[model samples]
Target chain A: MAKGGVAAERRRPHSHLREATVGYAFILPALVGIVALYLFPLIKTAYLSFTKTGVFGDSTFIGGANYANLVTDPTFGTALRSSAIYTVIVLLAIPISIVIAALIAQVRHGATLYRIAYFLPVVTLPVAVGMVWRFIYNGDFGLLNALLSLIGIDGKAWVADPTVAIFAVSAVGIWTSLGTAIIILGAGLQGIPQDLYEAASLDGAGPLRQFRSITLPLLTPSIFFVSVLSVIGSLQMFDLIYVMIGRNNPALSQSQTIVYLFYQKAFVEGNRGYGAAIAIALLLIIMALTAIQFRLQKRWVFYG
Target chain B: MGNTQPRHHQIIIHAVLGIGAVIMVAPFIWQILTTFKTVTESRAVPPTILPAVWSIAAYERFFTSVPLWSLLGMSLGVLVVRVGGQLVLCSLAAYGFARFRFPGRGLLFGVFLVMLMAPSQLFLISQFDLMKSLHLLDTLPAIAIPGMFSAFGTFLMRQAFIAIPKEFEEAARLDGANSWQLFWRILLPMTGPTLAALGVLTSLYSWNDLLWPLIVASNKHMTLPVGLSLLQGQYGTDYPTLMAGSLIASLPLIIVFVILQRQFFAGIASSGLKG
Candidate 1:
């Protein structure tokens, strides 16, 4: 469409110049924002990563010192592990969400209600979601414990216990993301030709058999998309952990992800250099993982 | 066999989804209930599902104690600038990319795509420095500036504009309409669904945004999320007040989602899978 428009405009050279000028004028603001806020900072982060931050947030070039520190830092290792675990745990939502989407698809009525109910967490502010969950996880008055006690079991301080805090936070990550995954998978399910299922039923295929043969194979593209996004989003988990687990919590160290670590180092401690390095590392990890997903997608994703 | 089995399947599906819905919405229901309960009842042993004596004291305290109104005002101001700016600017840029043969259009659009993948946190330190140098830190503009233009919005609009049949624009041009006139009169008015989708998503993002506003604004200038986070920090043990504050903070977006639920879901699905 655009090429045709351009080709026609090219017939009038003078008018073409005016059109190009208008084009530049139109894109100027977005261009400025992209350059100033995105491109420049991206480059600056790379540069800042090699420097040593001063007390006043100024940096002096220190030549891979921050990278070295990050490499040997036990805390960085722990954060890396926590983030990986969290990402994996959150990725579990993909299959769970697929099941829910499939179930909702099976129903003849009230699909909209199921979608809305699952999606409440997606729309609610993460801070609010975190707060509400925090109340539910409270050691004293938490609903989780209250329910557990009824079953002849006891509950610990879920978010405060170091061993379980990361898992607790990851559970929230899954719950919040389930809605988006369901919606994406539900759309994919809708796109499957109805006759394919009818044919399967004619062949005397059971529901589970039809799902395994028809649904899973056809739904790979959406699955790939949701998994890639969920991984990226999970790797960048900050607001939920920051709000739910909090700074003073005993499990803060164990629950902190890479982005949370970056926030603390750069913003709280004013160690801009180290923080920039962590952010860059995270950027590379996300890019690498996403690239891998895209490459691996060829094996599983059925474009048809 | 088929008919009876399917009825059984229907019952099982309804039972599963009904139970799942309860688990999903339980916290929200609890949050609402806790907002009206007194501190004592809110922390009652075994956790009372309903408040014995319903009172609005938590809401009253939240309003009186915190600068909830000003925080809301600041949040609204940021929302208007961010959403309005994104609509106008992203639409114009999308138009340019879609219809104009600029020299670096592909390259520039590529940069936008790259930025979409790069997390926003990478820019925090440098953007903060830029804000400080420009004297925007601790101000509403500071919160709004970086978010005013979104590459995602531009991309969505570009797709919308590209889907428009070229004949419409060709006819407009033949009628002696200039590029701006063509865009404003012909193309812009036709992208209602795309515009609505982008608007709803952008507002949802701006309303729920925490990290940027938390870092940029302080005290009276903080947005609702930042303010509510602070409330949690200060009143860590005050369940009722915190619940009340959180409810107030999240109510607007929830209401918006309820009203425009289809657009909201469409926006999420399209953005997630397509790009």
Candidate 2:
């Protein structure tokens, strides 16, 4: 291309030829990295899902056996259900975070402090975060039970009980993600012109009316961004659950996500082909959900 | 909207925010206090907020049981390389996308955006296989190589470069500066905030990453989070010792966050807005 560009430049006297050569050179590293790591692996995963992998990682074409097994597997059903429940439940963080962002934006003092405090969870290692929360949820001598006792209420083992374990973990999800949602929404809030609010006030709009009319509409873009990311992150949830609910936990079967199942099948059981199929399933799910969100965005995501 | 609230409203806001702040920070405080307690004290009913007799036994046990310093060294090594690679590669790619008019530019950029949207788990099996084929499994490079380049980083840097006026580049070109010269001397220096933000984000991700490292390394090569996970599995109910290990593992990143809080927040906010 550079050689052709040099030859063309002599006849056309165009600077674009030189710039294009430089541009290609500049992007070469990134292009190579992306293709080698991302694109190839993506295609390879898709291909591997159709085969059976041996103990030594040698694969043979198995047709639809893996997918057939995935559909019939009870564990896969539980993982899918848990993933859906976890994703839906964790989205509660969005509205709560929006309220926090609004409150922080309204206050004249200590905004930075609030942001720092809330963001602490986001920056901490998930393993560490899970461990700390696990200690707090311990049934025998947990902080949650102690706190409940102070209010004259009984608290069962939060993460040990399958019925409440997913919800308990989802609550931690909300706590950890609240900081990020707030920061994004806070930036969105700042983007809204104050004159709009002042104008609304002159026409007798109260805080609630002003918020409903102006803030919610203008903030929809950030809200959409946060919600989409939250959903994706929740669907792929593994680190927190793996650490908080151990392999022996009674709730493990009920609360394990698709990724956790993938890890178990691929690494623990050495079923690489089956794991690849699960990963592809997750990828397709993510794409479909993301596509649906994009399709629905036009209805509610206010561009202006 | 700043300082426009009535006095009574201000009080209400402060009260609500204060309570929220306490809830947010309570875990870290609990972890620290737990680190100093005895195992028996940690398991005491009504779980004492402060130990009756503070002890250093947990810390001693943690250090002796785990290769703490080596794990930290491994994590830091990965972080430095990952951050440095992303800074250079992402900036170069972003500059190319922002400044040049080339065939397939739109197509390549679209590819980057799609890559960003796809979950990292999609690449897990193949990435592991790649590492295995290259004989790089259970090594630091296996852990760091895949993370060294990021679609999100490229997109971010491209946006930052695009935000810069074209006039500067045109002026530099007229002054006989080449593309590399202009990028190095003019545009790069001016992108201090953007670079800092990227650096903070890349470092945070590399330091806190668990899954990739867990899959790629074991024992001696393990990074902090992976090593800490092993510690949890081995020590099961030793809450005090586990908390000690957790606190020690998290301290460096917390310190980095404290020092670069503004850049961290700005990076996350901008990514959300532009993404």
Candidate 3:
């Protein structure tokens, strides 16, 4: 059909407009869908965040009340702290992942096996990862506790204890994300010109010195990329806590992430207005943090 | 700088890599082994590497107890629709930006980028509200409609399409191929790797997604992840049975990653670098 159209267009000069119109026609479905579904909802959400509304379609204009409630809400504060802690702890995994990636790249044998092993957690469904980790973190018959007993160290109920619960969930965050970071960094490592390393070797540079002066600087782009993404992603943690911690768990208070709070308020509590406010606040925080990273990248993120 | 030093360095690298590999694989090994074990043996001290009573009880129970096959069918159906729609729509949008001049193109593309960066939660509440108003709630369309068009896919396909040399299109033009013919017959064939990569990514995301499905689909149209989570509520302490069910749910994604590791990395790496 397309070939037939081309042959017809060749005989007439007036069909160029028709051809260009077809190009626009091809994109119309997606454009219309995005506008109606995404853009309409986005603006409506912002409006609803500012207004007071109930489930019964009663909406009243209330300026700044929801945002005010967000500022003073105790749950919001706890969730913010949890989100910050989760972001920092999960970000620590990125550097750890880089070191592992560098090591894996140097191995000549069984690289494929190692790659598959490391990437298993990332490729698996998050619900599965959450459930598996929940089993491992169980207090009495959990594998971690059993292993700890063999070494004469008693393990606590990891995901149930308030003090350790956030860290427990963050561990899964790190574990699942390590594969992605490693793959990106490994690719960057491969792209580095080998001649530079050879030149450094001729200059009597040791392995540590070569890595410090060459690999670290050259890998900055991927490092920066992973850092920004990890931070943003960790700040929005919800699924693991939702599945692993359960709703009525004692440690739920300590490990409630911002998105989880949004879920509780919006769905569980039926405070759609308040939930929209928290979601907006989170969006602002993310946008600000990302903007700062972009601004700071001029100073440190080396493209080469 | 003799052969001895190089050998020593090689030894250090292997030792480091070997330890890292064990840590990465330990959890999966534990999960797989426990699935085959009986209830008591799985929880035993100094955990057994092999199940004492190797039986198909857990696997058999999983297939019999849960609506596992129906959930698998639901997930595959949604994945095919969503991925197919995304590929067709995103490629057309990409083509508009890549090959032709159009009005409001820059602003439209800017909206696409902003949609990419916007926190997914912000869109959820209103999207749900919209679905409710439209009477599409609790249906598969609620899940499929919102996800069918992705901004990230559009941006990625645009970059890939733009990277193709203009001479190919110009030569086609001289040969009397119009825009539709050029795109469909010539350009589309050349985008095999990018399209394959996008297909895999879209399917994986839609398959593994939990949140949106949890919000929209309740009983009839529940997806794999949502169904699996609900199953956890029903079967809490039975680790072996739970592991078997999860293993079944995750099998498709593992097969995908194994087959397309390179293309997956290329697609993800390109997007990450640009971001």
Measured against the true two-chain complex, the DockQ scores of the candidates, in the order shown, are 0.65, 0.68, 0.48
Q: Which residues of candidate 1, in runs, are more than 4 Å off?
A: A1-15, A55-57, B1-5, B273-275
What tens-digit string does per-residue lDDT give for candidate 3 at B123-161?
Answer: 888888888898887777888888898888888889889
| Model 1, position B43: C-alpha lDDT score | 91
Provide the interface RMSD of candidate 2 in angstroms, 1 decimal place. 1.8
Assess candidate 2 and give its lDDT: 0.89
lDDT of 1 by residue, B1-275 (tens): 12324577899999999998999999999999999999999999977888999999999988887997889999999999998999999999999999888688899999999888888889988998898889888899999988887888899999999999999988877889988898998899999889988887888889888888988886558999998999887888888999999888888888888888999888887777221
Assess candidate 1 and give its lDDT.
0.89
lDDT of 1 by residue, A1-304 (tens): 9999888777788877777899999999899998988899999989999998743766789998898999999999999999999999999999999999999988888999999999989889889999999999988889999999999888999999999999988898889989999998998898898888888889989989988999999999899989998888888888988899999999999889998999999999889999999999999999999999999999889888
TM-scores of all predicted structures:
0.95, 0.96, 0.94
In model 3, how large is the Cα lDDT of residue B215? Answer: 88
| CAPRI verdict (incorrect, acceptable, medium, high) for model 3 | acceptable
Model 2 vs. true fold: TM: 0.96
- Candidate no. 3 TM-score: 0.94
Clashing residue pairs, backbone N/CA/C < 3 A, model 3: none
Please identify which of the two predictions, 1 or 2, would achieve the higher DockQ against the true structure: 2
- A1-304: candidate 3 lDDT, tens digit per residue: 9999888879665555655577577678888988888887788778889888666557887989999999998989999999998898888878887787777777667776777777778779999999889989988888889888989999999999988999889888888888778878888888888888788888899877877888888999889889888888888788899888988789999889999999888867777788888889999999999999999998998886
